[model samples]
Target chain A: MQGLAHQLIAGIATGGIYASVALALVMIYQSTHHLNFAQGEMATFSTYIALTLIQAGLPYWVAFLATLVISFGIGVFIERIMLRPMQNASVLANVGVFIGLLLVFRNAMGWIFDYTIKAFPTPFDTGTPLFGGLVSGHELGSTAVTLVVLGLVYVFFRFTKLGLGMRAAAFNASSSRLVGIRVGWMLALGWGLAAAIGAIAGIMIAPVVFLEPNMMLGILLYAFAGALLGGIDNPGGAVLGGFLVGIIENLGGAYLVGTELKLTLALGIIICVLLVRPTGLFGRVVQSRV
Target chain B: MDAGRDRIGTGIALPAAGAAERSAARPLRLLGLLGLVAVAAVLPPLFASSYQLFQLTLALIFAIAILGLNIVTGFNGQISLGHGAFYAVGAYATAIMMSHFDLPWWETLPVSALICAAFGFGIGFPALRLGGLYLALTTFSLAVAVPQILKYKGVEDWTGGVQGVFISKPDAPEGLGLDADQFLYLVVLAFAVAIFLLAHNLLHSRIGRAMRAIRDHSIAAEAMGMDIARIKTRTFALSAGITGLAGALSAIAIEFVAPDSFSVELSITLFVGLVVGGVGSIVGPLFGGVFAVFVPNLAESISRAAPGVIYGVILIFFLYLLPQGFAGFPQRIRALLRRRPEG
Candidate 1:
């Protein structure tokens, strides 16, 4: 029973990270209707930049804030420079470009930072026990960080005019344009926010997984499963799905399939969810018109 | 079919008809295609070195894989970023059959093809529900997870875990004067031509038209009484079968099978090949095959550490300059020349 509790706690901690990345994926999907395959790579690059700042003697919190801002800018820049031109192109071409972006970011990180795994510093200290030893200090702190980010995103979308404009643009670009909203800028903003969120996920995850060029590949897959399981369109569902996936992954790894097949477990969940519920648990069913 | 509806539906009636008329003066295009095949078959044996023959064989194998990808993705408009998983399945099937059962390499091809087709059929059921980005994600997940699955402890008996399994190269018949590499190259070439011809025939058939109709408008195709689900599932199977054949050929040519060989990078390479070669054209996969076989080596030669970066840059450059791909170059040039004369 204690072991199971420990597994759940660990799963929730990891799931928080997955939720953040899943939310980022959902954000990009919301606007472009195209999944950014490079989202994971982009987050890794953002984390590298944060590491550079920390290595330059800046405080951890300062580096974190700087990384978020820089990641947002990079996302917007990518949208303006690479994606905007291909807006009217075929879906295959668009997807091809996204793959290209993934390669670029992944290889660029290896080129700049090298493929050596580096230890990332956690803001949370390891001295204290949390939740009667069920959760580590870092896990607790990371989950708290993830929730705070999620809450802030919720507030922004619910209360801010820019967020509302972005939502309107994503919901109906033509109608949003008719209403004088800058639809293109809204998309860029969406990409930026998504990048920022992905950066946080990466930053939080790196300490646990250790930082490397390919650190986020497995996490990204889990997040993909989560996003799909929760309904890729529903942000709240995605978050819930992320935690659920995390719990399942942990419990399955512990009791079911073992650790070697954990990635396959994620894949299996994705296939099962897709087969059973295409609209996802939270997504509205869309009808194809003749 | 109504000519007007064909025009509206296909958007290629006039150009295709004109091309057919042009073909009438040059005998049949089929004859020309066969002649090209004959040249491909005969020339390498006469002039190419062993190393060159090996490269050509690898390129042909890639062509088969890309053609398979083109079936479901290019023709049916289903994006599969996980064809490499099918390819891996095919390779492993061949490897295990040959290594474990001591089965003849020739016999494993059909078995591999059947296994991969089954996989595709199973995947297609889920794919019926997931569309567009969701499907791509699921497939991408498959690609990422496949290597790990292959390395799992339960499968280690057959898979050999990380070390992988290697097979002996098949030798030429005693009557033939050719060596193993040359024989393998010829074998791959024969398979390539046969598969290419098969794809060509399939794409030009009535079923091909239905597949394209579904791709262009699934709802409309369904309204017209086409069973969209059956067609798509079958297309997936066919595509996987062909790709599996390519993987079988690759295993023979390389004489090895490993989890590392069938990475997500392989899937990406095939996809890049499809896009760069042109999506829908019959010969596009041939171009894609050449790109897949040669580009990474070229990138590595330029910079070993950052070959992926180079590949990415070149990919973006091509996407920017030639959105329609290398297969569209001839058409683009013709359009340019026509415009120049008019101007």
Candidate 2:
């Protein structure tokens, strides 16, 4: 019972990271109707940038902010340069471009940062457990950070004028453009915001997973499962789905399949959700006109 | 006839070949194919070194695999980023059969094909519900999970876990007057010729038209009384079986099978090969296979990370500039030539 509780808490902590990544995925899917297959790699690149800044003697928080800004710019740049031209291309072309980006970012990280795994320092590290030993200090701190980020995102989308415009553009680009929404720019902004969110997820998870080029692959799979489970198009549902996936992964790894098959477990979850309830728990049914 | 003569006087032929021209070209095309096959069967074994023969064998194997991918993704419009999983299954099946059951390498090919086809058929069921992006996502996850599944404890006895399974290379038969590498090359070439011929026939048949129709517009295809689901599922099975056969050949050629050998990267490479070779082009996968086999070595010679960077850049650029890939290059040339006369 005690072991299960510990696993549950750990799962929640990791789940927070997955939730953030899933949220980023949903943001892109909602806006562009295309999943950024490179999201995890891009986030990994941002985390590496943060590491470089910190290694160069910048404070942790400052490095974090700088990384976010850089990642945002990259997101916008990629949208304007690579994706905008590809908007009207075939599905294979679009997928090819995304896969290309994934390869570039992932390999670039290895080329620039090297493939050796490095310990990432946590600002919240306290060498002690918290909440009656239910979670470690870093885990608690990271979870809190994730919640704060999620809350801010919620506020932005729900209350801000720019957020409303972005939503309008995503919902119906032609109509939004007629209303002078600058739908193109709104789409760019969505990409930037998603990139920024991915950076946060990467930075938060780095300490636990360690900083490495391939570190995000498994997490990305889990995030995919979470996003699919929550509803690919629903941000809130994706967040909830992330937490659920994390818990399920943990409990299942411990009690059912064991750790070796955890990634496979993620695959199974994704396939099941896609097959049984593809719209997910919170997503709307989308109909294509013939 | 006067206009045709005048156009030829400008050193540029018309965009479409006349029926008479096509008929005149048919025998030449057949002769060219026969000559090419003869060259493939004869030149490498006779002139090339053993190492070169091995590399050529690898190219043929990848060509077969890329062709398999092309069948579904190119012809049927289903994007599978996980075909490597099928390849791995095929390779493992062959490995286990040869290493455990002591089956001849040729005998294991059919078993591997059947197993991979069943797997593809099962996967195709879920695929029926998912659209392009979702299917890509699902297949990509499958690719990512394959290595882990191969390493799982339950399958470790058969899979050999991290150590992997290995089988000895087959020797040349008595009185063949051939080395092992030469014999293997011929065997692989024969299989490649057979598979490519089958694929060509399949793609030209009524079923092939239905496959393309579905790819172009599913609803229209269905309205034409084509059974979309059946065609799709069968296409998936056919594709997987072809790719799996390549995997079996690879096992024989390489004489090794490890979990790590069939990583998600292999799938990506095969997809890259498909695109570069020209999707939906019967002869394109040959170029794709050669590119898959040779390009990495060229890239890696530059740097350890060069392969990925090169693949990424080439993929993006090719999509932008050469969407039809190398197979379309000749058509592009003809189009340009025709445009010159107009200008």
**Candidate 1 displacement at residue A26 in angstroms:** 0.8
lDDT of 1 at B112: 98
**DockQ score of the complex predicted as candidate 1:** 0.75
Q: Comparing to the true complex, what docking class would candidate 1 get?
A: medium
Residue range A100-204, candidate 1, lDDT tens digits: 998899988988898899999998977888778888989999999999999999999999999899999999999999999999999999999999999999999
Q: Estimate each model's TM-score.
A: 0.96, 0.96
- Per-residue lDDT for B96-183 in model 1, tens only? 9999999999999999999999998998778754557666787899999999999988989999999888998999999889899888
> DockQ scores for all the models shown?
0.75, 0.78
Task: List, residue by residue over B209-322, the lDDT tens digit for candidate 2.
Answer: 688878888889889998888888899899999999999999889999999989989999999999999887877899999999999999998878889989999989899999
Count of clashing residue pairs in every prediction: 0, 0
Instruction: State each model's C-alpha RMSD to the native.
Output: 2.5, 3.8
